[model samples]
Target: MDPAAEGTTTISPQLAERAERSDLHTLGIEEEYLLVDAVEPRAVETVDEVIDQVPEQMRASVQHEYLRSQIEVASPPQLELSSLYDSMRVLRTTLADAAGRAGSRLVAVGVGPASGPNSRLVDNPRYHRMRERFGDLSPGQGSCGTHVHVSIPDDETGVQVLNHLRVWLPTLQAATANSPVFGGHETGYASWRSVMWERWPTVGPTPYLQSHEQYLTMIADLQASGAMLDEGMLYWYARLSASYPTVEIRMGDVMPTLDDAMLLAALARGLVATLVQEVHAGAVAPDVPHPLLMAAHWRAAKDGLEGTGIDLATREPRPAWRLLRQLVDYVRPELERHGDAELVTVLIDRLRTRGTGAARQRALLAKGTPVAGVVDWLARTTRGEM
Candidate 1:
């Protein structure tokens, strides 16, 4: 049966109990971007200088990442999708203008073509300690990602949402796979950033937890093991935000356009809302094995939407579009609830036709556009000028 046509199921006891208190679908987005020379498109170490150029009023929204060649911007929590888009656009335009004044450009690609051997760590004691502890994984680490935070009522609901959401995270990764090139070479994966990110000990798909107690215990164990710096370092693809009352999905590469980013945010918020509804309707989370989930993630990272992805329901190879459609169908009710169904449908159609960021980058290279030209295109598209 087509999951999309299915009628609403009964609300579970847990969901029914908290329906009155839940926020439903409030969202916030955070994106990291690479800073590069405006003319040459090479990664540049100027975050400190660029941050100074941002207007005083907007200063708090823009921040430095671990790498000096990278910067991050966050949108204030918003209930309307349009408000989120406007916030992102204003931040991007302001940051781009500031970078321009500093002879740099803010490129939204996953990793800069000029990154690798020369990447510099930001001048901070925390970053210094990370470099000292992680060693090889610390250097040459210049990649960016989009994180979506969807509000939940409390930790118990957040854990259930994470469990239900894990199976679909790979599909999310494939849809947003924007990091095709890294350190000046095509990495043969749509999201080379995922590969680069997995090198960190704490990153990847997390195991299902039975309760909030289990979640906290697991985090405590990881922290005690010295592999993690603290609770804030729990870098699973999705996790309860250490700083917010939301489940943060951190699986997407920084998208090439505002539309792409908003598409991701919409889907993320819809997924959270759908899962919350499922919990209330008394649906049990799927018992997908952790290893199989990891394999699906690897395939999505390897092929993106241009190739096949693992179907979580069957653990078999399926076309990427088919998996995406199933995901949409599964969350259709929630999408409609939040008024995102039309926007998501249109954006998915566009992605299917135009290809993902990796595919787009390859197309440019195939057309005899130099790597620098590719970077310029990404910068222009990021600013919504192209």
Candidate 2:
């Protein structure tokens, strides 16, 4: 044999172990919201006042982003499905109450209702430095989204789990699509947040990687090239968490209600858990390329469910509603495993019929009311007072 051939190793062992236990389900929700003055339609920075007035527990979990107009609410790590929903509901309620005391409201805007030069950045020193470093990354402007974290055993599983999820993320965005307008202009995108985010360094589909080592190598390469500062900047459409041992689904635009938020979180957790199980059982998944998925994502941002979406799996055009219905049934077993079938059914019925938050926002804007109505509507829906 040749010297080079004799020296090379043919195979690599498993980078990590499969998650053995089934009761390992853990979930959390991250809600990015806008702080709005009840009287003004624009975003305002009020995190300080809101946090100060809220209960101590909430104050601890609620954090400000680079923009003062934006605040992120994180649900406590939850072992049970009900607990996840409860934490989200309670947090929203507490924040709403606090906003009331401050003469403001914690409004959830996908892409804010109104936009102008009046937006205020959050006043934290760290945020200030962040704004300086990453000028446009912060919401010093306006846009919001919902992120769901589902804990996995380790990084290897996280990569495999996120790879499987990349295809359907655009589908989720189409179903949850909101943010028809941006900067107060009718941009014509169903989810303007998706469009606005393309300006960021990392906001698109992730290429298929076969194993954990391949995934790590790609990440290391990106970091070495100075394209990314660290693992934290690997903001692929669906990605393994650089910090948490969880998979983060960052597709859905900020929803107006707690029920919608909880439902989305449940779906995310269930999907990840099911995929993790399948990968553990020696299942080999098919390739869904990033370029094709990016096209689908663009369609989702432009038309939402109102237009035909580019199917990532088939590489063809299909109706958004048809695709969504199929996924609901396809994921039924997983939903059942998580004891969330009932809630999933309710969400499907509502989403399938009403279109999405973007559709509703368009209707409200057409009714001759000002953007303030949109802000109030969001506040009401989130508190379940609608």
Candidate 3:
């Protein structure tokens, strides 16, 4: 039932061999998107209706999100980046078509472009309890984000992967930061979705941990402290997935296009693959100070790729683009091993040349387009029509 299997593209045999070996580390992606009115371009509570319209064969891949106005679609894990990319593209196109049939547009971004209700809570007991516990911090519907999951061999290795993945987060955040406009105007911060998302008690960077046992201990402590209602609400920027044997990185806003999402997916898989090797080689995870790491996260969220960020290595401000390039270099061998170095390089160049999602949204707004028009643009671009 893998959609990517339907339209397989032929490739060089040498790259094909690498891609075959790359299956050891699979890639999975989940994205949350607002269901907005096609004309008014405001959040609409039609996720249920939209999901209902999904093709019967693809129903397993689509579901409701935290908000009633939000829907989520996950591409099945793929052993190869090309397959993962193809499946995701099909999923977006299919889900978007379903939304169109339901009279709403599925917008892929961090949050809605316009203001919405204080809460559009989905009708579920767990969701209700969360609302009771967090109140206004819980959006009835919530901001959108792209969650990338790369398979790890085991839990212990997953913990180590999280550690290695930490230093690269700020760069990833800057690379994918998309939410710039909210309430119909500029929010000043590059990723307003991330800014607003941090209002919740559990969301943000994860603390460096020693082992898988420690990872569980921390979660149990958070649950006992009332910061988390359940394991499902861990909400760390990156964590070991509870439902799957994968390291889930949820730091970035939902990228507006298939190519953008694939960039993150490829890098994530490469990072996980590289880190797993180090794990076996008995390499120590870099222990960055928590406060400094928090500051780095803040800078990336505030400025995105266009702005300078704190270089954790030297403890100095450097262009986010430079950090991103260094990250690519750090994982180049793994990218090559996965047969994705070329594609990843091309995507990185395209992203840099066009600017991050936040920059793109700000650019349109600067031209005096109404927020509604921005919403229209979001819809079109998300549908890959732009």
Q: How does model 2 fare in lDDT?
A: 0.72
- Models, CA RMSD each: 6.9, 8.4, 4.8
Q: Give lDDT tens digits, candidate 1, residues 330-351.
A: 8888888778889888888888
Clashing residue pairs in all predictions, respectively, total 7, 3, 3
**Which digits, one per residue and each the tens of the lDDT, describe model 2 over residues 1-386?**
01011111111122112123455557677787877776776776677787788887556567765466676777766656787777778888888898889778887767676775645665655445545655766443566788777878778877777678877777788876778866667778888788777876666777778778998898899868765655666667677655556787877788887667776777787778788887888666667765677888998888888787877778889998887777777777878877888888887787766657777887788896566677678778767787
Segments in model 1 whose C-alpha atoms lie over 4 Å from true places: 1-23
Q: What tens-digit string does per-residue lDDT give for candidate 3 at 56-97?
A: 898878877777888888887777789888888888999999
- C-alpha displacement of 246 in model 1, angstroms? 0.3
In candidate 3, position 298 carries an lDDT of 88
* Cα lDDT, all candidates: 0.83, 0.72, 0.82
RMSD from true fold, candidate 3:
4.8
